[model samples]
Target: MPNHDQLPTDEERDMLRGSVRGFLGQHIAGARTVDAGRQTERQLWKQLANLGLTALGTDPGQGGLREVVIVQEELGRAGCGSPLLSAALLNLSGVVEQANDERVAAVLAGMHTGDHCIPLAFGEFDGDRSAGRPALRSDRLTGDIAFVEGAEGATHFAVFTAGPVLTIVDADAPGVMIEAATAMHLGGQSRVRFADAPTVRVPLNKDGVDNLVAIARLGYAARAYGAARRAFELAVAYAKERKQFGQAIGRFQAIQHKLANCHIDLQGVELTIGSAAKQYDAGARDWHWFAAAACVLAGDALRQVSLETHHTFGAIGYSEEHEAPRHFKRIHLDVLRHGGARPARDELADRFLGGTPDRLPEYDLGPAANEFRGEVRAWLLEHWSGERRAAHQQPPFAEREYDRAFALDLGRTGWIGLAWRKHFGGQERSAFEQLALMEEMERAEAPRAGAPVQAAMLQVYGTPEQRRKYLPEILNGKAIYGMGYSEPDSGSDLASLRTRAVRDGDHYVINGQKIWTTTYWGEYMLLAARTNPDSKPAHAGISMFIVPMDTPGITIQTSTTMYGGTFANVFYDNVKVPAANMVGDEGNGWKVLTGALATERGFIGGGIVLKVAHAFELLCTYLRGVETDGKPMRLDPIVRQKIGDLAARIESGRQMMLYCAKQVDSGETPPHDAAASKVYSGELMERFGEVALDILGLEATLTEGSPGAILRGRIEQNLRHSLMWVISIGTNEIQRSIIAQRGLGLPR
Candidate 1:
């Protein structure tokens, strides 16, 4: 299977996107109009045929659903209407399935050449029962089909009946009447009434119908994503250029955060659609699930993004003449097609609440990593399950998250430093392999292991002696390092830290205090102190040292967190550290500090999301078996919808995590991308906790040991724990600034 984690960089795909975008740029002017008339629409259809877009998915060499997605996105981006989705993809799909039939072959040929506009009229109108599926009796059709897109100027109609049969009928056949219908958007939709109209059977079976429907859903979702993307781009541009209060509005934190959210939302829609399409092309059996997920997220995300875009554009965008309004209409209309998000949500709810592999869709993390994931999973089952896991969980909740003996055991397997260089006693595994390890460990709810950040720093900047002393201890899980960077007054603003270190002979005398040190009980502290107080910039005078926590004159005052975890305010009153303990040159600690912090932030992003995913799974398990007022909670429509939404968002967060991991594998620091991941994932955790409580009610708020507490009170504990994720590891507000400035190039 293709590496869907990476952005599409193939020359052919790039050329295809570029050519389609270029065509739309030149031919389509202003906001698209549905009243362009049938002749103009046909002319545009012929142009698309010449571009080979209509031939997509018909031949393996030409392209498949992936290519079709690209064309659909471009069409949506331009706010241009086309027959690509209805005639080219949907109708063509039916004809291709029955290509052995001479009549079907003739229609397929005409479709490919753009000489025929054959719209597929399948299923009932979403949420409207006025028009229902046609019936097939004795090779004739009689019924009314509604919302048949691309029905204007059509030469034929591919009607799917309740008999599970696909039949082709001439548009002008006797007793067949097509009337223009008012639609939510400008697409040429019509209602067709058939009175025993003779039909030609297309030989499509049940599987064929399923396949076509999945593709149609994905196609509509792709278009919605494209429209949302275009609207976001326009809003960003306007924010950059439109001035307010003597500066670009983009400089305002309010505006910046809004656009930042839109960026993240767009990523979710784009990645989900791409994943579904790629999986379909690879012939994965679960592609239908992904398609449903894509549609669900697209429908919800685009609607919000559309509204936000207009809000950013203000009064000007409210006008129908603005380009933004066109995109708004297009997004709403497209996503609402093909049964909308409700049916898709129901499909997801079935898989999640049903007893069959009750988990979210698995991502394809490439072959090597996929194999490694299974290996890690099996290893966890052996080492962390049954009596061993039960014994570990017997401890207090906060302490159970870490176990020295278990960490040492895992370290012995040589997986602790999987991504470290071989020179540093590591296996030198790929980043993907490391990601697999992280995922499996989190899913297994295993205790945290490895001192990855410290090991990484020691490898990059440690002296030979320092490496010899710390590397083995870290790799063997014999040592843990606590970060001593945040002082009471210098949390996110690390440069303002006042901690001082003065040289005295061969030792540095350290004096200051660090607050919120969660790992204060660890063996050593990664300390940052000011060496030259009078330097041009305060941070320019900072230096880093690895100070032993047992050093004299150091004091630790511990306190319990609201979530029952312990952290300390550690004070250093003239503590002495050996000069040799210092890593990197003096006054360059900023680089070293940021380097380690970046890695931590990336993992923090992934870790938080995995926690959310696991918690969501537990909630689903509870709902599956629990009853409310004599009814199963799983049967509740509101409950199902809520679960389905969370499931889709969780999948999106997983994709974002993988995207960041791919960036790391490419040997780039990717600070902004990591920040995006961290911000989105962290906030998602908070949202999940709130939604869980809302879904499960007061019983969910009971403490862990309380009687009748849901999920053993994990839901409430997690809700409290979630507050720390967003606040620690750099606040979500700070991360948003990073995304706005670094990712979007917005003014600070």
Candidate 2:
């Protein structure tokens, strides 16, 4: 609660992370490339055993559940193939969950020892079974369960029987044929076949299907999170190192702002996976739907990170050796292998329409979610009219001034500190309120810049003086601030930043280079620097300084992104700041940062970014104007499909975004909801960019300033800018780790 930067506290999270990370480090990290695309990694399994990664799903009498989930996450990270998924689902839980046999315990034991691997296979294309009728001996799962992962080494198969039944079989048995490992996305995960495999009988009636689906969905969600984390990490690392125009890609306002957006998305991902995992652990049931949602977000996150990491890396990332292609491939496989994002839609539709509607997770927004809706609606009606709508319609994401205003308005309305305690500029809102407010903002397309997150941090750790000085400035629209955290040499390893501030009587004279300062144009900046580098720990010696832009000896050098505009490189040469301007006690910067980032479940995917909307609008307008390939480009199935997919992603993203908002509104974090949504929304934007360029063909090659440039080359600009969204923030890869580690209690 102290900070968004504060790390997770659960011991299960740390232990799981260490165990799985150790396993990957020992086995797959340096494995030879047995095959270019498809690796039949036999030696890899024993290593997983040596590190005790395979038996994670077993009850504590054997090992731990958290460990197994971490293994799933690691599997995605390493892009290493393993059949432990099968063991956990089918042999360990699925088939036994239905049968009353001692074999269940034996299989569970085998799984713990890595004696056998088990996997389950059921798909959207698994042929329709006649309702309430017997599964024909010949029906035999007539459709291919495409992109099935972990079946290669599965000792037993748990096949989804029609309705609520599970049919189990030995993978090595007659009628079950193991096919050569096939290539998909990521690297080694594979797909195999039934080809009329004989069924293991499940009686006509049973209810293990739900359990079976949960195991599979949750596993994939973990995998997705892992992949997303790697993608995000790669993006962030790439942004920090990759130079563009004349400086690191990070030192551009457009890039830094985009990265801020990316960070929000990553926070969302952490919330989703963590929430879903908690539910699973609680035996909350309905893990099927919960895990489904997590996967949807994970897929979204993975796709977004993969695309952006490549963009951030440019040509280097595009080449096969860069690891970007493999990560992208993994995203596609994990998403499509299951019913894809469509199932999430079906699940949501079913939750809202199938049940008593009133029974859908009683969103206890304290004042019921609808109550806040009514109140906000009343407030809007009383306040928002022609002038207000006109003023607000300037597109929240694009209007810098309005963005600050939105934050001020929300602060005035007491919505900005919805989650903080009433004692300190907050309403002490519940998780539901926080989530609800976020959803409301998204729905209203409200701007959120003035609040700048640092306000929340101040509430947690700011001295009374700091609060009095800055909170009002933030709440009102008087002061705008930039995050001057990263410097020339420090990015991910932020503790090592080199900026310095020396004590000088009533002030501290600071001098150093600060790059990647977002919105350097802002009036005030939150600068993290070293006040005592000789102090024992690097983290402890740091301090936060609130320096006014007008301070003497400060030169802000601007760097343009591949897009446009700048994130400035700030040079503080003996710039004096009063000692009173410090945020808290000196040598407490890291502590303050930790407090700031704790429980930071938030927006995933960039805000309904204007860049994406602009791209879509432009593509639509272009499609209407001309024909391509002998037919209007708008009419082609591929074009239509891309558009259709984007629309679905957009809509789903909106809901997930709202869901994330709901969690935030109630004063509860929304990690799983946020991560998945952010991932999906960001990726969808990239997808739109790629599809738009393909449709534009040569037209996209033109620069905006060129004589014959097409539509001022907006598509090209968007393509270039989209990379920033994925690379900034947590990077999709880091997001996945959060999901896997914090969300699912998986091994890191």
Candidate 3:
């Protein structure tokens, strides 16, 4: 297994996730079906937002989009109100030229200035065949828009029209009517009508006809990410609380398998959305087709997740008071609001020459992929050592000495750079072999925290001198690196970083800040800084640097998160470095950063997450040992059901991890593998935490070390940590955006 000094590929993130188990056990409320409008319980949202989510779409000059995305999923898990996500997406829209009118710009800008309500009005799918035009009209918008979610509190609506006539209308416009609609979702909706509301006019094909639709599709996908995340939590929570035939239902095979299916669907949809978001953010032309497909996939995904979630709860899920009904209501209402399922799909087919018949070539995942898997597994077994096994027993966020030693062991065996080029201390193994190794590691529940992804990326794109300096450190384990791409205001937008590095003769003076630097204590950090402040086209003037953690004037201030890890605010106040320290050429930072995640953004715990999965499995074994009234907890169907579901999710998460491995083994980057893996794995971790807490009942609130606590408080820990999984990395919303843009090729 890989060690903590390594970072897992996006596909392998779930491995080290056990850190959250303790939190979930302690903080996540016990699982008795959550009440409707429990939305108020989302104290987690306020806690995280202050952690600085509003700045995600802004630049280093403002904040970051990555953390915003990460925070987005946590909000989803909590099922809270949000204007941050929409603002981030809308900001991206403006950047890519998708926002056509003045109204759109104001709407987006308003979000950053304390505006908490921004709703979008794309026509909802009624699951109908009526050819009738939308009864809603713009004299000005004289009739009701059939279905809209979150509209009850909207200040403005970004309305999508058929022709070149999009607009933003005030919710309280003159002659406007807002009737609370009978939506099936747990979140409510409304039918908005205008007798003669004044609407701000915008272009339909301002950029391209397909562009607006793609943008609209992307928005839905984002919302779906929010919805699906909640639904998964709902089902998982229910599985643990409801018992049947003398055991927890969660332990039952039938319920577990059903949740597994939902897990898979959730992963797929999340992947679709992530692909789309990436395409839009990167300004990939000809991405409309991809965006449409992603929308369809995302749309369908929420529906299935919502439906399965309800099914898992049976009759209890049906009660209006149950959270399951709320999730279903959101799914059904949102499903139709944008384009139903087919508009996005049909739009996708129209873009493809053969109507999406030959859309994406099938990734070879059969014999060869499996064979590659076997080879890696065999190799890992052969290389298994005494210290490595011992290291596995330590928690993922354990003391650094243990992680560093374990990482050293992996480096010694040459597994750390098994796929690296020999010239630079790597084996220069084939891409397939690299992927094969990852597959084996993930399935084996191997540690992956400290892999040299940051270093290797620098090597691949850095100047020769830069490579000479850091490549050895990466290989020898003297300096494991962490990514500094994210900052308070600069998440997904690579070009907007404001960390500035200036030249002063022989040295480059770095002055600025980088936040969300994951391994705040790692030996070295790969920081992106602005070398050319006025470089045209936004992304053209950046440069990469290998900055030491203890560099003078460079302060790494740590911020604690509810998830238990401390991300740092790395401040550089004229920190001086030799000009030679710059990675690649000065002003070539964009090129270097572009492929930083070409392999993957990384597993949630990077190298250490899989350990959590193993720990969760251990928790499950212990859960089976629990009992309340003179009977083993395993005897209760619902308890069994919840545990069974967790087991299955672990399996599915592993499979998704493998699918990414297969893609890598096939010699190409798995486009949506990370998104697919991250969403499911994150949800899986969350569900496990929630279920464990629920099965514990009132006793669940007791802390792990508290007197008479059940499962040693493992349930509460998992419950709290699950929320972290939702927000970390690219956050599920950002992942969905990537899917919609990259996989589906939708508009901005």
Give the runs in model 3 whose Cα sits over 4 Å from its true position: 1-402, 428-449, 602-613, 698-715
TM-scores of the candidates are 0.95, 0.51, 0.49
On lDDT, who's better, 1 or 3? Answer: 1
Candidate 2 RMSD to the real structure:
11.9
Query: How many clashing pairs does model 3 include?
Result: 123
Compute the lDDT of residue 158 as modeled in candidate 3: 56
Which regions of candidate 2 fall more than 4 Å away from where they truly are?
1-9, 30-43, 46-69, 91-97, 102-105, 123-146, 185-207, 242-265, 283-292, 318-321, 350-748
Residue pairs whose backbone atoms clash in candidate 1 = none
* Model 3: worst 10 consecutive residues (lDDT sum): 353-362
lDDT of 3: 0.57
Q: Give per-residue CA lDDT, model 3, range 1-748, as digits (tens).
A: 1121232233322321222223333444433222223143233323333444443445533322223334444444444434345445444444324555566666655555545445554442222333112333543665456545455656676555556455567766777666664544333345667666777766544454345445555654555566577777666766776778977676665665566556658765565555544444444554564465555665656787787777777887767655555555555654564455555554433332221222231123456555766766776676553566545644433232235654665667665766677887777665445545554575454555454567657667777777777777677655677778876788866678888888999899988878877676877777888989999987888988887878888787787755445678888898988887787888887877766665554333222235345555555555555566887665565664454344334433544554565565566654455665666677667766676667667887676547986555556655676776666566666665554445433333
Superposition error at 477 for model 1 (Å): 0.6
Model 2, 215-300: lDDT tens digits are: 56666667765766676677666666667677877655454444444444545455556555544554554544555555556656
Best by lDDT: 1
lDDT of each candidate versus the true structure = 0.83, 0.59, 0.57
lDDT of 1 by residue, 113-156 (tens): 88877777665323335446788888898888887766666778
| Pick by TM-score: 1 or 3, better one | 1
Q: What overall lDDT, based on C-alpha atoms, would model 2 receive against the true structure? A: 0.59
